[model samples]
Target: MSEQRTVPETETETDTETPEVVAPEVVAPEAADAAAAGLPAPPGGSGRSRRVLAAVARWTAAVLVFGGVGAGTAAGITAMERTEVPGLATESDGRWEYPRLSLPALPQGSPRPFTDGNEGEIHHADLRALLLPAPAGAAVDPKANGGWTTRDAFLSAYGKEDRPPLARALDDSTLRHIAVRAWTMPDGTRSSVHLLRFGSVGYAEEFKDALIASEGGGVVPDILPEGAAGAKMETYGDDIDVPDTRPYIYQEPKPYGPEQIRWAYIQAGDTLAVVRQSRKGEAAHVPFQQTVTLQNQLLG
Candidate 1:
């Protein structure tokens, strides 16, 4: 097991830097009316609130733009309050409401994995903090509720036949730690996220390669999840473009027993993330894609 510590809540500091404000083209008549009515204005028009929103919008755009440039760029973006942003504020598109995510504080003098002076690309923060938090209204699994878990617990996700080989591989891969989080949504969609950290980038890559390799030109992993016998490559249209990370997404073909499963493997630096979602009848693609994308962003 890896060392465990309490992850401190990130403190919000007011940005003192002044932003170069751009004038809006259209000022809604409702802005003044809304203000006079003691309600907030629509997310436009010229005012202190609009300026703040504009600044946040620009900052969010920069984060998304820089995300593809290199590793660690997305770390700063996850700290922003999602509800404060306009489009992201609501879950109207079948997206779950996840809490504001922030990278855990590193030990003094420790450089970030992709930053200068850190060649190993090792995460210096607690693994537990890297696991995505359960979304609103989710019934969290008490067994794997964002904490360090044993190797056996991690391997249990695989079929019984595949678990032995995976266990052996994990033993030889210089695996350092494993952290997990799991929850069931109101609609019966069960989701779990597992993060495996290795001693170095080479070991992590080797493990990921071994796990994903298949006999034919198949995108599915060699070892399927507990109940899934087979899966086919699934495209959510929008791909996550974070640097130093790759995602392999697949969905269990129809005629599955009971529930359909969608899973993805995210190989990021010295860590590999496995995200799995299963639902009876059918698992919606939008939420699965949204979940995987957010998790990949955090790992980026």
Candidate 2:
């Protein structure tokens, strides 16, 4: 397992209301006796003081009762599991259970990629530490186990015929590092994430533009993933709102063979990430989207 830096999960605060306290009617003994005897009670006597004291006692008791109920409700909510709470429980949505994620520490005196004063927008952290971790129960690929990889290893995902030109482009693009992580889930879904860091944001954007060109009324990558004859741009049903990142998602068109492939190219600062997921029959949309969005977030 690769060493990771993790941040605390955000805490959610729940608001609980105290039930209203309604004081019961309190009558002085002298007043009740006088009313029963059809005679008025003496004014300005001890009855007024007794009534005031009795009312104060009743109010105090009501306050204590309601306060205890509110405290108990809060405690019960805190003790219960998140899934046990009504309206707060999240049902299974086919999303993978990934490990907690946090940005890696940068070298002392180095600014973050997207922070002010870093005009080039270069990532100062270790590339391997930035790679997304494999989801729970995934079988990780040793060759691409969240570590540095050769350019050829990254190019191997594309068809052989396109490798030569892509290699030349990478050389000219000032590619700095390539960090990859690949895994397969129990459901037979294979996922690979590649982060290619360039010398600057300009070079990264240029290489990304060169890799993807317009084709047949849509944009498609010049070098398609291995086993994918053709792919088309796909718009995600849900919006991915990572800051300072742009994702170009593509899906293998219909009439695919035994398996289907879905991939995305995320351009963020000096890093361009390739996230791919394939499965027999059909590639699940939820997991692919989830993977791409998360990778983009990490890069951002």
The candidate maximizing TM-score is: 2
lDDT of 1 by residue, 240-282 (tens): 6567778888899978888999999888889999999999999
For model 1, the run of ten residues with the poorest summed lDDT: 1-10
Q: Best candidate, lDDT-wise? A: 2
84-120: candidate 2 lDDT, tens digit per residue: 6777766566777788888899999999889999998
Instruction: Report the Cα lDDT for residue 280, model 2.
Output: 95
Measure candidate 1: CA RMSD: 18.9
Error of 2 at 283 (Å): 1.2
Q: Model 2, poorest ten-residue lDDT window? A: 1-10
Q: What is the C-alpha lDDT of each candidate?
A: 0.78, 0.82
